[model samples]
Target: MPSELVFCHPDGGIYGLQFPMSNSISQLDISTMKELSNFVNLLSRHKNLSSIDLEFHRKGDVRAQRIINHAFSLNVQQLTIACLFKKNKKYSHDERVAFPLSLSGSKTLEHLSLRGSCGLFDEEIVLTSAQRFSSLTTLLLHSITLYDGFLSMCPNLKNLTLFSYRMTGSPVLRISHPQLSNLTLEKGECFTHTVNGGRFHVSAPELASLHFFGFCPQMFTTGDGFPCLENAHLSFHSRLECISGSYAPTIVNLLQQFRNVKHLTLSMEIIERLNSSEELISHRPCPLANLKSLTLLPEVATFVQHKHTRVIMSPEVQKYLLSSSPKATLTEVLTLI
Candidate 1:
């Protein structure tokens, strides 16, 4: 193979195949295959393909499955399948069943991303099938309802990212993956439907980098010391104060758990919450001895043309964070546009 071909369309499938000088292709992204026979006939000839991307509109189960079946037949290293959501339409049961079937026989897959909702029933089958990919390393799941049994099956998974999960019933999630070094949890709104929030008990001993954004977890319990964690990003909304008056202590305790973090990022809302009650800090000094870089995000501007470029923190707030890590330089502030 001497060429790569990528075809992306919002509605229909590609009708023609163009290769430069070779008979085989390297990469392909066939979106919404209206003609499965044509796509199968086109891809069956190219055995050297390494990466594939397939996108499907809501309720295109038959077409999506056939395309996926053909794509997985090759020795691909990366595969991305998205069952796009439509605002007015609900996904059919057949589409959910077809989601995991696409990942069948993926032994050599290294990177995989399943975006959009695959429904709860199909997700269980998807997680079960994911375990067969022995070479899998990185996985990203967006808008998925995750549970305890999901990550346990991925023994070889190293990097995991979960976004916008709608969790209820106070689920207790346990992250006990030893090989997972980098973990990211963002855009999560947990425990809205239920009275009690959930708990996440992490046991990633080799975890070196953790980035948390948008919403904070209800509670976090570490299995052991996160000895290898080097970078951490923490952001929380200001509304947390309304949830509980003692959120300062809760936030401080969470920070204390990451004693070995070298690079830490915090939003302005978090800093204000931590410093809201001076009595807590005076009673318990939560120092991050290994911290080297502290980045503050609250001071960031909302728009590009805004006037303020640099943000200043009150002396009391500066002293509070600096006291924990005396060797840390002045906190750096950056805006989020």
Candidate 2:
């Protein structure tokens, strides 16, 4: 028998095994019940672990919950769980895995990532008292349905990344944190459609960097603005036809929130949209006031001929963008698709 055993399939037969010279295994990637059992057995011999990554392909809610409980018991610092679903496969409500409530109160955990289709704070699970992740600092949630008050669980978080997040029970998504410094919001695989003029309200006084990609919300409000911000990157893409007049004002207003940023970057698509809205641009002053360096990125293209093409900003758009920050150095970056 080998020192370490791993079973990739649901059957009891072992497919692979490993023999370590010493008890120094710190990280594990588990997918099946047999693998999980071997992990539990290995834990008795080696008590110290750094991280655990778990992936589930089908219905294994009970096993998944048990794995999470065991990870917490071992005081694992980093945990990542992803529940993958097959294409065109329909699963019932009960088949969906619920986020284990037991791990919410973990104090040793520092990083947590949850991806794919999983239920978070579903109605089936109820909490009697408040739960807090006292030591968690970094959190990444992708392709998951989020409920209000989710951030309240992690009080000391410093970095947050939300990709394709779908909101439940409220149209408005509010993010307010005191110690948070970096925030990235990207419209990933599950872009939430704008309904009833959906919006985002962010209030992070200590924020230093901000990156927003894909379709922007109808309205983005940051109370008192990001006074401590130094870097900002804004890129907008839409599936529908680009209507300059439709998104011009919203983009302009969004830029105003980052007026204090010293380094700024804009995509070519944004420049084009602003160019067609000359009338609108003429009326409003430039949002950026003090920029150290401004960079323009080329739009992505699939054609072979357009791979290394240089992107040039029209004089009208350049003047409008650089009017307030005349001392800022301008640079256009060449991008290859």
Candidate 3:
């Protein structure tokens, strides 16, 4: 019979793998479970092992915890969990799988990728029992729900990607890094509630690139500690019937935050829609003097502007930047409009 798990090496040794599910957990006979347990033990003892990938199919937290414990018991550097269960109208019954908090014991772990369920935000995963992942540097978490404390504990992480299934308040994040870089958010995760607990939430700094699902005029801010982000790729959906002028303050405040940003990319996707060059370019805002690159969907470039006025960089701002760092700052200036 073919094995459910197999590891091969052409050189024929240093190691190889074959394992059976724990106990009689497999769909097959009991003998294989014993064989599988032995293989898992061999894998745990293998010194060269640096990573493990797990599939949680039972939709039960108990089994998931056992498998994760096996991986953590090893000095694994990376772990990836593919969660096959999804939450639908059935609700509570489907959320029994292991939450993100249950897998925190891998002290040497450097990278982690998670999917399936609303695990990260599960209320049962208590933070007090969680151990600090001293060496973790990268994390990718996708869920139907996520909250502030998810990142509050992972202090050493450098690169991170977060995706949420539905819209929710922007969970505050406080990051500390000496040489960290990339950051990304997908879908509804980009929208944040600035007035959470009556205080504005901030994101990580030293981030080089930021990508979101839609354009958020509220994302830009004048807050004293906001990141002077360098590159941004923002997406947008067509505005249908919004309360006219209802978004003015949010829009203004958002753009003001990008005062120090340099490169901006805006994307607007339309289904079976045709737009003219003028209509597209008109909405694009005037480029800042410090901006080195600008990209826009045709409608935004045509419509996003200071009413009928031209979108041009101010001469004073350009001269000031050129005087400070001509080689790095003044060498490239692009006007998309």
Candidate 4:
């Protein structure tokens, strides 16, 4: 009946811990902006505090790094930084906010995520910075640039996602993690591409899931690209530009490259606003063959409904869209809207 006595058998399932402390627990709300530096310092001694998530908004630069560093001292296993920052490219370039990229507090961090800040880091800073997070397995960063450091140093990385991945130069990638299974890429400025003479390689072989938010789906490479991809997600935004040869034409190849993909998540913008007229999509059959799940959000349905908006797929085209792939059987699908 005591919390300390609660345990789970190795071959058995999870066991619930029961608290034995006989005391009235006072409700302390941290959201009220309590000045609890002393309390926080006390909790810092708890070695069991291995995982922590933080969201800071409008809380004017309150020594965030220190709080984070303290959490590491408490054996934090996971750390997520979701800060609110208006677009400030100059500040990111001038100030090394993105520097000290690694966690100095807990050298044993397994997961780290930095998101929701625009223009806080440059491409080179993140790439070549000295890293102490040798135990990291999962990493997610947004509003920053990635360099070769991300690709080369993160040998233990299992899952990676870069939201708003804005890089200036073409960085060499040497990713070869076998445990890597999931990948998610979000929107960012166009990565300044350098002339790549070598082939695109994936050192990882266990990758099974992938999601591209605001991806230029038209990028199709043939040899040794996306060999083990199973599920793919494409999330489109309103401001997303749909160039003819790049995005539109590339759709065929993307569908072809991941020919065996089972699930496909099409963002509303791609499904709806892509065609000047809905009629364009009416004729083209769904390309993916092994697709089993199709998520049609409300936005895509709304885009298909507009009359002057082009050829929206009617029941006839809808049938063709589904039947296009013999293996493209959507067993559990979402017709949102």
Candidate 5:
């Protein structure tokens, strides 16, 4: 067996099986409550566990929560919990499980990732005051429904990655942190339609890097802008059917927020969208003023399809992108998927 045990759907029951414990075993991956119950005895023998990952396929189990609490009582520094129960089905408000607040009290935890169709805050568990994660510097939340005051709890957070997160009762998702240095947001179907009117407004003075993927939001503002930003990467999903007339202007306005970035990378979808708006490009100045290096990622396909085999950029598009930072070095990257 490997140092880490990944428990999925086992053919036979795990109750009578004896797991050989080694000092090198420092991580545990459990998917169900039954697996956790069987592994509970093993945790005591292996006291040096540094990471624990749990995934719930059905409902949240109190016994599983107890095991997780026990693991946190140890010196575990990293914890990842993905509640797969929220996948594909429409759950009633009462049926949703609130994230265990007890796990946030861990003193040694430096990285915590929570994902997969769970509610972070609800009526039962309201975050009235700050529940500080003093040692937490990195947090990744995906496919979660979050409220506004949640991020205020992590005071010393430096890196935050949010993928497919939905906000509750708020159209504007505000992220303002003094110690934050890197930020990433991957858009999802929840924020695709304009009817939702969802947007992001970030204010991170110390932020140095930013990565945004998928469709452009209705409005993306960086309070006064990131004064310390150095690198930025934007990869837009190619969904031309959803692309409206306002898409180009939205991209242009969003780019202006990162004018001071030294290194920037853009995807082929973005280049194509910008290229189609020649009249707009001719009127407005290039958004990046202090750019040092520009990297273009051209779309590529797998060996099965022989369609896109090369990077293509018209001279007009190149001139439009480098109008402000003419001296910046340009590089093209291609990846076969």
Candidate 6:
């Protein structure tokens, strides 16, 4: 038997896999519940599997619970379970209940990613499963809510990624993880439909990398602080109001917050926003004395089409940055319009 098994399915349904008869299997990927059940039953003697990626064929399929139960009980180190939604309907209530219920018993799990259309929240699993995540070091949540104190329960968490989630009304979101080192937030489509809560206040004293893509938060402030941040990447998707004169200052303040960053990546739009006024640059120049490398990403669409094979930066913005951080290496990325 081989140590790894790969199952591929374009749409969905049971698919045949090139299975290895070994019990030392470390990774498994199955497209549908049918295939998953067959493999598990056939390999009944297998108990050393350490990672699994299971995707269900339907939104509310009852068989998904079985996969969750089996996967959770194995205490796999890395697990990703997603029950994709049907055209209009999201997940069934039972499907949603299955995951949290199974997750409550996790003992050896370290990295977990859950992707579903709806109904999964931190609050649902925190109470019973909080203690179970003592070994969890990383988490990725897609289309989930943060209203419940879900994050506070992970004591040893080091990396986190949030996608397609909403945060409303609260004046601030303060995340304080003692060992957290990497944080990425890619705001999904829901960001445009809701009013965002105020500034993001983070307190990861050991944090080293921060990345934000999509809509801009109202404000970005820190608590105990990100004293160890060495890399920062930022990109925005909406039109930033330039006439108000307030946008540039906000950006300057944000940049100043991470003055110690060594490597920085920014979208071309951010530089354009800053170039709107020369006075803004002169008065609030970011003191990036430690900056070693700088990369400017072009428009998202063009960057994707060109496969990021070229670099482009406007002379005006390039000159402004060169003056501020003369010792840092400059990298410009071009995007085809």
TM-score of 2: 0.74
> For residue 65, what is the lDDT in candidate 2?
54
| lDDT for position 327 in model 2 | 97
Write one digit per residue (lDDT tens) for candidate 2, span 76-113: 67777665533223545545333333444678889888
What TM-score would every model get versus the actual structure? Answer: 0.74, 0.74, 0.59, 0.58, 0.70, 0.70
Clash pairs for candidate 6? 1-20, 1-21, 1-22, 2-20, 312-333, 312-334
Q: Residue 317: error of model 2 in Å?
A: 3.5
Candidate 1 overall lDDT versus native? 0.62
lDDT (Cα, 0-100) at 156 in candidate 6: 79
Off by over 4 Å in 1: 1-3, 7-34, 41-45, 87-105, 117-131, 167-170, 190-198, 240-243, 299-320, 332-334
Best lDDT among the predictions, by candidate number: 5
Task: Compose the digit string of candidate 3's lDDT tens values, residues 1-337.
Answer: 2133433222111111223332221232112335446646766766656666665443343444555567777776777765544444445753443334355566788987866554533422212234567788898876634444556556777787766533324333333443356666664432343311111244555666666553333334323533656776655433431112333344334434554567766443211021222232234443343566555443233223423212233444234223333343322212335
Q: What is the lDDT of residue 208 in candidate 4?
A: 79
Off by over 4 Å in 2: 1-47, 87-103, 117-130, 193-198, 241-244, 300-316
Give the alpha-carbon lDDT of every model. 0.62, 0.65, 0.46, 0.51, 0.66, 0.62
Instruction: Candidate 3: list runs displaced more than 4 Å.
Output: 1-36, 86-101, 117-130, 165-180, 189-200, 215-228, 238-244, 268-287, 298-337
Cα lDDT tens digits, model 1, 1-337, are 5354655444433222334456664444444344456667877787656677666554444665566666666767887766654433364444434224324656788887767653443322222233356777898887655444656656787999977654433377677787889998875553243322345778888989988765445677787768888898887654432235456666676777778888888877566665566666665555677788788876322223334444455666666566768788656556455
How would you encode candidate 4's per-residue C-alpha lDDT over 112-132 as one tens digit per residue?
776555543532224334345
Model 4 TM-score (2 dp): 0.58
User: Tens digits of per-residue lDDT for model 6 on 1-337?
Assistant: 4344544444432222223454443434455667667756854455666676766544344455665666667756877866553442354444433233234547688998876554432122211233347788999977654543556766778999877755433445567788999998876434334433235777788889999876556667777556799999987543433223456666666777676789999876567666665576665455676888998887544122333333344565566556567889987766536
In model 6, the runs with Cα more than 4 Å from the true position are 1-47, 60-62, 87-105, 117-132, 143-146, 167-174, 195-199, 240-245, 277-281, 301-324
**Model 2 — which ten-residue stretch has the worst lDDT?**
121-130
Q: What is the C-alpha RMSD of each candidate to the true structure, in Å?
A: 6.1, 6.4, 10.1, 9.8, 6.7, 6.9
Model 4 ranges with Cα > 4 A deviation: 1-44, 55-62, 85-102, 105-107, 119-132, 168-176, 190-203, 215-223, 236-241, 248-250, 266-289, 293-327, 330-337
